[model samples]
Target chain A: MKTLTPIEQLPLFTTQIKAFINWTRKNALWPLPFGTACCGIEYMAVVGSHYDISRLGAEVVRFSPRQADLLIVAGTITEKMAPVLRQIYEQMPEPKWVISMGVCASSGGFYRAYHTVQGIQSIVPVDAYVPGCPPTPEAVFQAVIKLQEKISKGDTPSQRLVAKKKMAELTSGNLENTGS
Target chain B: MEYHFQLVHQIKESLGDKAITSVETGIGNPFECVLVVRREDVRKIAEYLKGQRNFQYLMDICGVHYPNREQTLEAVYHFYNRDQKQRVRLKVPHKEGESVPSLTPVYKAANWFEREAFDMMGLKFEGHPDLTRILCHHQFVGHALRKDYPATQNQVCDAPEVFSFPPLPLNEDEDVLTNQRTLVNIGPSHPATHGTFRIYAELQGERIMRAKAEIGYLHRCFEKMAETHKYQQVIPYTDRLNYLSAPMNNAGYCRAVEKLIGIEIPARAQYIRVILNELSRIIDHLVCIGTTSVDMGALTTFWFCFRQRENVYELFEALCGNRMLTTITRVGGVYGDIDDEWKRRCTGVIKTLRETIDEVDRLLTNNKIWLNRMKGTGYVSQANAIDYGFTGPCLRAAGVDHDLRKAEPYYDYDRLEFDVPVFTDSDNFARYMVRMEEMRQSCRLVEQAIAKIPDGPIQVNDPKIVLPPKAEVYTNIEALMNHFMLVINGIQPPKGEIYSYTEAANGELGFYIVSDGTGYPYRVKVRPPCFPIYSSFEETITGGQIADAVATLGQFNVVAGELDR
Candidate 1:
């Protein structure tokens, strides 16, 4: 996959309009920082003057879930907080993505206690996982760029889920016809 | 000294002979008096302590579980006298199902502490107003802190709490005759709330008639997790408590462990610890003031303060590889030593932040909207502040010229020269001023500490506690065995309990550690300073504008990681 990326072959099945939409989206990704713990502080650091997230076109951090296209789960998510996170995700409009920031949000890190959720993937489908106890802002920026690449490719989690479902349906239909 | 002995005598005389069990003094713990009171006399003893002996500050109320004891549950009440610098712990041993008298009637601060005791330890407090689960979800089945409950048995509760206000009271001076108050639920995920904290505000027009905050959304169970891990492993967990000042928590926890083990870290380590702690405090105050200004619609202070904070974090990153949760301090000393380049970075950041603070002061100090909004709102008197367990800047803002650094003089605080700024207003603006002044003082402390620091080993030289040097481990056979033993066995001290506190950026962050002659802790309860302050927040803002409550909250710096745990 790393070798194939250098060649950068364009897919024949996509349209110019789709390409333009992805291009615009890849540039201007509004992130909602669902920051709750130590990673929240690092997320703020990413927005600080030193990191200057404005250069990446993801500077507009929307607090409301409705306004954001990307959800940055940038901290630990407890069991009590999982439902609220789900509700917020469901509140967002379509064509949304999630960056599970830090070790806590990705795999609960070292906090394997009663209240903490092991990983946010149990509830929310994640597009990227930034690995660090509290990932540096540079790491977060890298994750954002990686997410943009996926967005431009039209390879989203929801889109892939739908595609997988269609393939399963097609296979099941073939089996039924052959059996009959 | 007289009060400690008199406390037991007076309680026994007032509540009859059966009310008093026994009195123990300084059993390897810092508290002056550890009174074993009968279960029924909890409230009465609290009343006597507050009214007679001036133990106005109900420091904390925590419950401990001893599975093998005759009474499996014991509720511990910590009371502090500000003037005398004395602390008393009341131990009430009771059965699991038995309900002890609540301390809420005596100290208003006991409201959340008692609820948390019930939530975690399953010790019921009789007549605790609204004694449901506080930290855990409302539907949480078992007490998570109990020995029987599995540490990793996570429970899910999806239902949001149904917040209800009291029925509209009939008022003689009412302009309108009907019930017109509206309930506004502010947080849990909102940007104004720094973390996962919810405020249920009952508003009449723009005024908040009553407010109740729901916490525990970020309850990662630090205590339960601490008990499961080795003693040294808990330092990283401490970092999350007040993430704004991670090193302060590290220093506090290390100090507690050092006290328990009866080992003094080298003077050089102490100086370095002080420097790092003051640095963390500076950033903490900057973030608090900056964020508070941001909440008031000034965005420039956030940028200015965060810029300085990032610079400090860079210095921390240079010292230790990590930025935010830099578990830099170890059991005896610190992770690594700083060189001249690092010292230069520290002084440079300190100098730049002083100018940035001046800029913020110019923007905020005399602004009309700032004064009008913050001056007359969220007032807490000096006496009332103590009653509500307000510590650190919030306590100082109420005209209590008390600073733990000055009073207790931990580490090199005695050698440092700084003033504790006090304000008599006890309002939101006072809190802002206190924090600003504190940042200036913290800057001074860091500079002075850097000047006084002598060249020596960063880590303690003790072979039993700390690991052997890398070169020694690689070459010498004895050093290899020492390193192996230290790594595998961890730090094991004699069985004892100690409550060691340090002046954290927010307030007094106390660590109540119980070691059972092993590497792993028996029980660890963090006296999170923000917990009591956040508890009194609702009462402080009653009958004030909702805006004032929001401003007050930012000033309080209620870190949910510290508050919930």
Candidate 2:
């Protein structure tokens, strides 16, 4: 084995390594398609030949949470489906992001009723909100680009740490709010 | 109209006069006649209609809440006779505690409709075999469709307990049961089940012994919201019912409200509606065939189908502002007039779509694997299909030549020349063939409608129902006043109850609205076609392989939005 030089272990090398990691992660994000209603159809259109989300490196749709790094929640989430969404979010591997893809998924849109959840953010943190009753395929592509930009600028290691910290804060906050 | 009156007279004569309380004709509309029967005599009356009177088709069963009446809850059943080409509405009003006899024994299609009635309005069926909540979670509290229930109340709940299937006991006397059978649960999120539907299947070896389908993951309480919204506002809500065929829903709801108000739209608008409806049917069949092929492991056909679907969406975007949720129809007519450019572009897209569908047909129709997966997979007999109240392509595929457009034409559908495709195989492949042929017929209809469209006003001349153009409203005081009144007060139909049905892409999509001479509807019941089609799913997939379940479900084209709503 060759001996490591002192200059090879400098801070510059670590910064280059982190940049490379961020670049690759931003370019290739495997998405879990959590589609429930109308927006789901638009999501499929985005992945189809015309809008072609593959241009942005998001064509690989993973149905399982364990293999995906991005969660595209594409439609209305009812109260009965909230816990299941949270469980899937929990099941995802670390360093994941969620894109709330339509008006109903963002703020319940026109369906402010008994069964629908107000917005998915009540249960999980959202990184980007694509807003339309059912957002067009172009709008979905724009959201994917926005998420990619966030991934590019994000401090990869610090992002994981911040997500963990936020999860803890949300848990404690929910516990306190429920107690009163 | 005379036939309906005579049918009511016969119903009164067949059952004693004491069985029926009163007969109300022309209460709101001239065409619809209401027969009020006692709660206990509903079964006897339904049996008489089916057995003696030949009203074999039970179209829909729904509940209405009349808060001020002595009998607060009413169960309404819509029946049709294919041979006679007649329809009747049977109303049975009961108090809160009274239970209506289950009609499932008479028409097997009543199984899920009764469950939905119970789920929505708390109307109990006396002898329903599996009368659990069909469209709401088991933990849901008050009935949603009752007048007293608030529309905006949010019921926060925890994760539902994991549903456990009851243990299946093996027969010790049978020598075939040497191995243990396993129970498998497929999705409320599985990709193959399409959209948030769960099915539990008991499997012994590779064959499924029994299967039960559980729905309601996408129930957004549309009917509850409709009661609170104005009539015009409910049009957009219908778009989400079957997202693939949105314009058909818009036209269906608009026609129902138009029927209540008794106004006829212009010739140009009716032709435009026919064009849009046939276009929607084409796209719906495209999605169904494409998705079924994808589920059976043919990926290329999905791409080909979506390519055409994208073109159709582009055409819709040119007409309306949005693509999929095109709220394009108004109460009395369509939102805007179709220009020459739109007509040219739509024709071009339809031509391209025909070629694309042909390519898809060449790819999948003769493939050996596709045939093996779908040929005899989910066999539904003609008798069972009619008993289960299958409609649209599913019924036609079972050799029943019943098409609403042909039997009781609406919106100038009689003017168009088209063929209703029917097949006798009554299997998964038969459904595929029927949908494919229907797409060709729809394309022909669209071409004819575009060619024969007359030049005239798009909306009726009723300022009370339709808003005047902004140019007229800005310049003329009368137009401005009319626009102001319409925008503020909304469309108000007379007090009446009417059930309007259209041949939707999936089946016969019916809307039964009871009005109280108010801006808001008293009760709006959407009879989604998928409700009954999905009810027979368990029976269809019982003896088939587990893989065939996915293929069968995809061909059924059960959209969760309509099914749960």
lDDT of 1 by residue, B228-259 (tens): 98888899999999998999999999999988
Q: Where in model 2 is the C-alpha error above 4 Å?
A: A1-15, A155-158, A162-180, B1-10, B25-33, B173-177
Cα deviation at B249, candidate 1, in Å, is: 0.4
For every model shown, what is its TM-score relative to the native structure? Answer: 0.94, 0.94
- Clash pairs for candidate 1: none
Residue-level lDDT of model 2, residues B404-491, one tens digit each, is 9998888778988999999999899999999999999999999999999999988998889999899999899999999988878789
Can you tell me the CAPRI class of model 2?
medium
lDDT of 2 at B104: 93
Worst 10 residues of 1 chain B by lDDT: B23-32
**What is the Å distance of residue B67 in model 1 from its true position?**
0.9
Which residue segments of model 1 deviate by more than 4 Å?
A1-15, A159-180, B1-3, B16-18, B27-31, B169-179
